[model samples]
Target chain A: MIQHLIVLPVVLPLVMGVLLLLTRFGSTGLKRSASVITTLLVAVVALALLLRASNGEIAYYALGDWQPPFGIVLVVDRLSALMLMLTAVLALGSVIFACGGDDEKGSNFHGLFQFQLMGINGAFLTGDLFNLFVFFEVLLLASYALLLHGGGKSRIQSAVHYVVLNLAGSALFLIAVGVLYGATGTLNMADMAARLVELPAERDGLVTAGALLLLVVFGLKAAILPLYFWLPRAYAAAPAPVAALFAIMTKVGVYAILRVYSLIFGDNAGNLSALEQPWVWWMALGTLVAGTVGVLAARDLRLLVAYLVLVSAGTLLAGVGMGTPAATASLLYYLLHTTLVTGGLFLLADMIGQQRGKAGTRIVKGRPMTQGGALATLFFIGAAAVAGLPPLSGAIGKVLLLDAAEAGQRLWLWPILLISGLAAIIALSRAGSTLFWRSQDGDRGGAALPRPQWVGVGLLLATSPLLVALAGPVNDYTRATADQLDNPDAMVNALISGNGDTP
Target chain B: MESLYAITTGVLSACGLYLTLRGRTFPVVVGLTLLSYAVNLFLFSMGGLTTDGAVVLDGAGDYADPLPQALVLTAIVIGFAMTAFAVILAMRARGDMGNDHVDGRTREDSEESRR
Candidate 1:
């Protein structure tokens, strides 16, 4: 049972998703309890994995007891464990939020949600490139279904663009993998990295092309400039709980970039060393600027929050571009803070939209709401946290990122990051004033917001202050994760490192 | 033989890309299908372009690389499912929005309909 812990994150979800699917005719109360219990179990498993990984040991569980480089392996390190924990907690919040009546609009909501969690956890845990692609499809399949849930004209429109763009992206992903495999003759990332170190000079160009192709694929996922046009509409049109769960989807792309580059193309890979640096650096800054402009341009509250996710993506990608352990640590900390808060904001926006009669989430004047004061307080806390105002998790995350940037990177990161923060604050304040303060008093018409809604919003939004309080231990964990990532030799050597390149 | 294989894959990919760029959903789905075929072929050839090789690893000369075949199989299954989903989505988009333009809008829909 103890040895099976590593695979539990992936397998438990698979089993639960299937079980939930079988109970399609079951009561919503039963389904919700089942999903909530399963997510809680996943969180507990993730916590255990996190604690074990903190010992700095790299262990991989081979499916079917198959050996490395031959059979699929699920590698657990500090980073994977951290991401798994994040996914589980975020999923828990989203699932609970859905129980507040979002699930009733669509069939198989609980089932699809569980499958989405399965795909996400699998992607975080897998060590093989091909396996990663499969998990990506798993997640994409689930996301496509979830996106169209409680469908409307707008949802249909956005889903078309999202699906088409992602299909292209997946094709590109396959081509990249094929190129890498042809050049290195292995799909296991550890094995690929080991072979790359001693790759004959003839294959350098092939490997470089593969690496760059991979960057394009991940960039599309992370919603960097030139590939982000699909994100805002798709995210904005999605149901609130579904959109909140999607907060971590971009992070998956960021994680892929970090993992592939650091492990396969790191210092030991000879000519391929840090080849992703310049491209990611320049593109990341462009994304930061683009995200800020979007924030200012946003006319809808959901669109604004979606743009905020983009800003967070850019900020994290900048840390990736910096290519230092300290920067990695800082970005990890920021990742934890940003994912939870943005997810909470989406749920809160839904609550606010519910009470606003016809204005919905559009950033315009609306009639007064019964829970205006309560909603205002939550909005203030969320906006402050997301915009990097002091005494919140966002401020701590930004400071850590700023401190990690050295002289050269600081030149660009400082002004751009600071200005983005100011933009966020300005945008959020304008939105808040239109939402809460500017509204006229009348009937205060709209159904009373449900209890589960408040609980769900609180569960996610409260993470901001909690992260601030637990800054020390969280920072240590992130710092350690960074150190572990910086050293890829441990993973490669533990795998089939000495077997040399395949034919 | 190698050049022939490479050229075929390239042409298929080029056609797929052109199709995907078209204004309608049907052509786009066909294009994605074409592209996936190209990808599967490309992935298959990655193991090497051997015609007559041992299927299993008997430790003989030119034993076939089974991994790429396995990979192509998975890709085909996944690609098939995606194509099916894309078709259904296209149908639904047309049914719901009353048009099959990829953006769910036709020319002269008025300014307010535009994003």
Candidate 2:
């Protein structure tokens, strides 16, 4: 039963979601509690998995006792466990915030929320490629509803583009998978990696084409440059809680890139890896530049935060592109910091919007807020943390990332990162001053938001510093995850040995 | 026979992409549906077409890979759902904003509002 914990994260929320859907006609109170309890349970299970995986333990759960290369498998290693924990943390925060008011606005919000978590968890844990596609659809389907949760003109408008782009992305993903399966007769990741090692040199071009196609799919999802146009508009228009949840969605794309690239097409591969390296670095840099410009040009608070999300994606991918264990480790740490801070910022932006009323989080001159001081303080912390100010996890993560880049002797990386950091700081300061300081209206104190909302934002804001406090252990875990990915032989061996064996 | 399928997929994709780039929402949705069809066909063909192959694992006759078949079947279902959702969303946008443009605002709407 303990071994079955691997599947619980996916199943718990699925069961809760169906239950919530069945009771959708009833009061939302019960549904909210059920969803919250399910998310909390998932978080606890994920934390347990993270602890178990800290020592680089790889556990494979084969459904129906079928062997690898044939049946579906779910593998939980340190990287996946970390992602699960991150998703759970963000999902918990988003759900709590949504329960405050957003969930009541839409029918089946709780059900959709639970389904979203199940999809995300499944995507992280599934060890097969086809299963990954199915989970992607599940998540996207739920997200489509969540994006339109509180029916608004702008929400549906932007969501149309978002849905269409992702549909195309899904189609591309299917094409990539089909091409990959055709090239190498396996959809299992480990088995595919093994097959690649022995594949005839003649079919290398076909395999490489499939791999590049997969890259395009993941790149689109990650919102890497030229493909990120859908993000700012869609994210800015989403309900705050949904937007906060989306903070982890882009990371899913990054995680897939890291997983697929490192495991299936490592630098150890002669021609393919060589061809991919420069392209990744150049593309990552382009993303960073685009994100920085967007941050500077954003006209509203939520849009600014949305752009910063892109910046974080760019930064993470840049580090991963460096292709060093140190770089990968720091990127993991950076992913943790960015997810928490961005989610916190989104929730905080919503609260600010609520307070400002007609001004609505726009960077223009707005009315004085009721809870100006408290909200200002929260915004300051969130902005500073995300901007990589000192004494925060963002700062630590950035420093580690820079150190890794420098160690890797990548001269151009540190400059771009530092410059982008500067630009973000300037942009965020402009936003903070415009929102908090410049406005001195007739209002003294605005209405106070509810207790749960404050707690949700506060918990999310506090998580960044907690990362700083536990920097040592978290760094060690990320380093171990990086090391594990650096050498896929252990992972491959583990999966293959588990063949035909029932635990 | 293979060339025919390949050309059909290519032509469908090209036409789908062209329509997808149109400014109107209906065209975009139709284009997406077309593109999905093309993709489904492409995925279906990946299994290497077999004329007289066993559908099961008989270990005797030539068996076309059934995995892509299953995958394509699922993809077709998802594509249908996605098309339905997109159409509804487009309808909702039109109802709410009185426009079917992707941006919810046409240039004339912006100009008139500004005036």
Tens digits of per-residue lDDT, candidate 1, A240-316, equal: 99999999999999999999999999889987999999888888899999999999999999999999999999999
Q: What does DockQ come to for candidate 1?
A: 0.88
Global Cα RMSD, each model: 2.5, 1.8
Q: Which stretches of candidate 2 lie over 4 Å from their true place?
A: A23-25, A406-409, A499-502, B107-115
* Candidate 2, residue A129: how far the Cα is off, in Å: 1.1
**Worst ten in a row by lDDT for model 1 chain A:** A494-503
Label model 1 with its docking quality class: high
Per residue, candidate 2 scores C-alpha lDDT tens digits across A168-187 of 89988988898889888899
DockQ of each: 0.88, 0.86
- In model 1, residue pairs whose N, Cα or C atoms come closer than 3 Å (at least 3 residues apart or on different chains), thus clashing, are none
